[model samples]
Target chain A: LAKTTQPISMDSYEGQEVNITCSHNNIATNDYITWYQQFPSQGPRFIIQGYKTKVTNEVASLFIPADRKSSTLSLPRVSLSDTAVYYCLVGVPFSSGSARQLTFGSGTQLTVLP
Target chain B: DAGVTQSPTHLIKTRGQQVTLRCSPKSGHDTVSWYQQALGQGPQFIFQYYEEEERQRGNFPDRFSGHQFPNYSSELNVNALLLGDSALYLCASSGGTSGSSEQYFGPGTRLTVT
Candidate 1:
C-alpha cells in the first residue's frame, strides 16, 4: 500500500476554489488516485478519481502528473456546505479472486467560511 | 436508489463482550467491505467479502470477523472487544470489474467500547 501525505487542515472562503494536494511518492504503476469527501456523521462520498493527467467531473477535478507520485483534488466555487474532511487514497483496482482494497490517509480537513 | 445502509447508528459495548453490526449494500452492488475508523485517524480496512466468501482481510486480529450473506448484505462481528475497539465501523459496497471499480459507503455504525 502507498502511504499518502496531505495537509492536516485548510481554510477557504465561500465562492473560492480549493485545491488539496496529496503526495504518494511510493505509488505503484497500477495504483489509481481517488478522493473522497466526508462530512460529520455521514459516510465518505466519492469526489473524483484518476490514473494520470486530469479528470474532471461535476463535483471536482483530479490532476495527476505523469510521475503519479502526487495528485490534486480541485473543488470549484466552494460553498459553506463544502466544508469537510477530504481523503486521498491510492490503490489498484480489484480483479477476479483479488481484493484490491483502498488505504485511506489521514485526510485534509477543509473549512469553508461563510 | 438507496445507498448503503448500516444498522444501530450507534452502539455501546464492554470489554470481553461480542458485538455484531450489519450492513446493506447499495442497490446493484454485490461486493462488501468493512473498515474501522478511529478518532483523529483515517479509516482502516478490516476485510472484504465477495461471492459469499472472505476475499481479503486487513491486519486486524481474528477478534474482528465478518460474514457475507447470499443477498450481498454483510455483518461484522467483534469478539472479546477492547476499549481500543471504540470507533466508527464503516461498510462500503461496489460492483463491476475489480481493477477500476468505484465504491459506495454507508453512514457507518459508531461503536463505543467501555
Candidate 2:
C-alpha cells in the first residue's frame, strides 16, 4: 500500500475552482490514483480516478504527473454544497489474494464558503 | 439503484460488550468492506468479504471480525469491545475484487462506547 499525504483543510469561494494535491512518494507501477468526496453523515463518493496523465469526469478531474509520486484533484466552479472532505488513495487493483484496502489518510477538508 | 445500506444508523455499547453491525451491498455488488472512522480522522479499513469468505483484512485485531452472506449482505462483529472501539463504522461495496473498481459507501454506523 502506498502512503498518501494531503492537506488538512482548504478554503474556496463559490464559483471558484479548487485543487487539492496528494503526495504518494512510494506509489507503485501498478497503483492507480483515486479521489473520493465525503459529506457529513454520507459515504465517500467516487470523484475521479487515473493511472497517469489526466482524466476528466463530470464531477472532477485528476492530473497525475509522470513521476506518479503525486496527483491533483481539480473541482471546477465549486458551490457551497461542494464543501466536504476529499480523500486521495493510491493502491494496486486487487490481484490474487491481495486486499489492498482503501487506506484513507486525514483528508483535505475543502470549505466552499459563500 | 439503491446504494449500500447499513443498519442501526447509530449504536451505543459499553466496554467489554459485543456488538454486531450489518450492511447490505448495492443492487449488483458482491464485495463488502468495513471501515472505522474516528472523529477528525479518516476511515481505517477493517476487512472485506466476498462469496461468503473473508478475502482480505486490515491491521485491526481479531476482536474486529466480519462475515458475508451469500446474498452479499455482511456483518461486522466486535468482541470484548473497549472504549477505543467507539467510532463511526462504515460499510462499502464494490463489484468485485478489482482494486481499481469504485466503491459505494453507506451512511456509517456511529458507534459510541460508554
Candidate 3:
C-alpha cells in the first residue's frame, strides 16, 4: 500500500486558484490517485482521479506526472463554499481480495477567505 | 439518482454496549467499505465487504465487523464500544473489483460512545 503526504492547511482568497500537491513515492503500478473533498459532518466526495497526465471534471482537475510519484489537485476560482479538507488517496487493491480500500491522510484543509 | 445513504444519522452508546450502523450503497455499486473518522483527523479504513463475503480488512480490531448484503447494502457492528469509538463512521461504495474506480461516500453516521 502507498502512503500519501500533503500540507496540513492552506488559506486562499476567493477567486484564486488553489493547487494542492500530494506525494506518494511508493505508489504501486496498478494504483490510482484520487482526490476527495469533505465538509464538516459529511462524507468525503469524489473530486477527480488520474493515472497519468491529467484528468479534469466539472469540479476539479487531477494531474499525475509520468513518474506517478506525486499528483496535484487544482481548483479554479475557489469560493467560500469550497472550504474543506481535501484528501489525496492512493487506491489499493488486495492481492487476493474482492474489496479495495483507500487510505486517507490528514489531508490539506483549505480555507477560502473572503 | 440517489447517492450512498447511511442510517441513524447519530448514535449514542455506553462503553460496554454494542451498536450497529447501516449503509445503502449507490445504485449499481457492488463493493462496500467502512471507515472511521475521528475529529480533526482523516478517515481510517475498518473493513470491506463484497459479494456477501469479507474480502479485505484493515488493522481494526476483532470487535469491529461488517456484512454486505446481496443488494449491496452493508452493516457495521462494533462490540464493547469505548469512548474512543466516538467519531463519524463512513461508508464508501465503488463499482467493479478491478483497479481505477472512484468511490462514493455516504453522509456518515455519528457515533458518540459514552
Q: Could you list the CA RMSD of all candidates, in the order they appear?
A: 1.7, 1.9, 2.3
Q: Against the hidden reference, what TM-scores do the models get?
A: 0.95, 0.95, 0.94
**TM-score ranking of the models:** 1, 2, 3
Q: State which docking tier applies to candidate 3.
A: medium
Model 1 stretches astray by more than 4 angstroms: A95-97, B96-100
Clashing pairs in 2: A94-B99
The lDDT per prediction is 0.90, 0.89, 0.89
Q: CA lDDT of B60 in candidate 1?
A: 98
**Cα miss at A112, model 1 (Å)?**
0.7
Candidate number achieving the greatest DockQ relative to the actual structure: 1
iRMSD value for model 1: 2.3
The sequence of per-residue lDDT tens digits that candidate 2 reaches over residues A1-114 is 899999899999999999999999999889999898999877888888899999999988899999999999999999999999999999875432345588899999999999
Ten contiguous residues with the weakest lDDT in model 2 chain B: B94-103
Q: What global local distance difference test value does model 3 have?
A: 0.89
- Number of the predicted model whose lDDT against the real structure is largest: 1
Which regions of candidate 2 fall more than 4 Å away from where they truly are?
A: A94-98, B96-100
Q: Whose TM-score is higher: candidate 2's or candidate 3's?
A: 2
Tens-digit lDDT track for model 1 on B35-107?
A: 9999878889999998889999999999999999989999999999999999999999987443337888999
